[model samples]
Target: MAKSFTKMLRAPDSPVKLSKIPSDAHPGVDSKADALRKLPKFAGRLADLQERLFAQAHGGTKPARQNLLLVLQGMDTSGKGGTVKHVAGVMDPGGLRINSFKAPTKEELAHDFLWRIRKALPAPGMVGVFDRSHYEDVLIVRVRDLVPRDRWELRYGLINEFEQELADQGTTVVKCFLHISRDTQKKRLLARLDDPTKLWKYNTNDVAERKLWPAYQEAYESVLNLTSTETAPWYVIPADRKWYRNYAITRLLVETLERIDPQWPPADYDIETEKKRVLAS
Candidate 1:
């Protein structure tokens, strides 16, 4: 059941046009209210799995080297931050590493593009969430021509190699591309402008970036096509409705952690002996 839901959301290997996918899709969900209602159930399961994964990694268990990394890529106003707040917020913060990658700082730029990305990877038994990740090198860098086409084009392969290495090292990578319609983006951006509370999120540059929507779409298509691998496949979540977005992502994370099937490590000492000692004390 979880596999089927994940299969439905996984991006196809063939080239895709973002317009072709519905931004408000709610597979297996009846309505917005239904999705909202179901979210907490999924969140609870995710929280439990996270605790087990953390325990396995830190409880002096032998050969403890498993972790989960969720990579989120999307246009501005596509709800990356919202997903983190709603879905990842349920997990134990001690076992989670949430990294938001923005423009490269001078020190970051001085090193390779993935230098900071590698440093931000979650340790064994941790859940790492990247709000905007290494794919930015291929997305905005390509659309805005921050780097030459020749250089950025080569990054797809490098990204694939990097992810493959992560998989080989026991880190399960789940990449999600929040797919929002142009109209939805416009509405969201406008809502930000109208609401004083959300005004801080309203960036004038977002409008400029929206102008190159077609270019951004093309760049993203290239990413989903080139970087979506067996080890680190990309899932495109419809983001028109915030409720559905949260539900889909929470479900995905729940399914993913279930597949990992982390266990609480066995006690090194005899449990009965420990219990007897505690009772005697």
Candidate 2:
């Protein structure tokens, strides 16, 4: 039997040391070629499952309350956008809700941190993708000291409570921490600088952010430890190899949807009557 990336990549209940984890390792895949070969099949399965979920929501007498939310968190250039392009981009757009949360706007900052997050959550039967999510309140905010120590410290519990609430309300939350080596980030950043087509992605702020990599890692470690719960667990994906990162995350999504096992809702109208009416028309 194939190994379950969901199990292999999931963050353990105990503390996780970022340095001890190998960011470039491909846990289940043999090579990049192997991952590339399997990706299309996984993507196809994901699409089919998403269709079932969408149909259940729109076509059922009692719509399914179940939905999915995929949370993607990583350092700069860990391929969160690339994952969305390759993995999520394949699914039907109608069934998917994609949100890329930026720094809080004036209105967002005025409200509780989760107020904006709540607004962006997926409706029933939809698959939601958050590229950089609520965790940033603890991560960048903590690393940059945007809030006081006591203020940010409390968010850990608040995040846990919020995620547990999501689970109670029928959202299957899959949070992935894309674990990339610092060296890989350096290479990617340099590539952005060197390639004309990629030049627009290059940012001076990214260089400045690199200086605080240690602090960010520390913040992430705390997040993985504190917020990883039974209801909304975190999976640490090895992301130095982009192909494996995509493959692993896609595998996780496929398995999760399969477990949900959404079915095509039964037809409300009588089939014979509908057929006869169509023929008469």
- Tell me the whole-model lDDT of each prediction, alpha carbons only: 0.90, 0.94
Expressed as tens digits, the lDDT of each residue in 136-155 for candidate 2 is 99999999999999999999
Best by lDDT: 2
In the predicted model 2, the residue pairs found to clash are none
RMSD of 1: 1.5
Per-residue accuracy of model 1 over 61-95 as CA lDDT, tens digit each? 48479999999999999999998998899999999
The lDDT of model 1 is 0.90
TM-score of each: 0.96, 0.98
- Misplaced by over 4 Å in model 1 are 1-3, 276-281
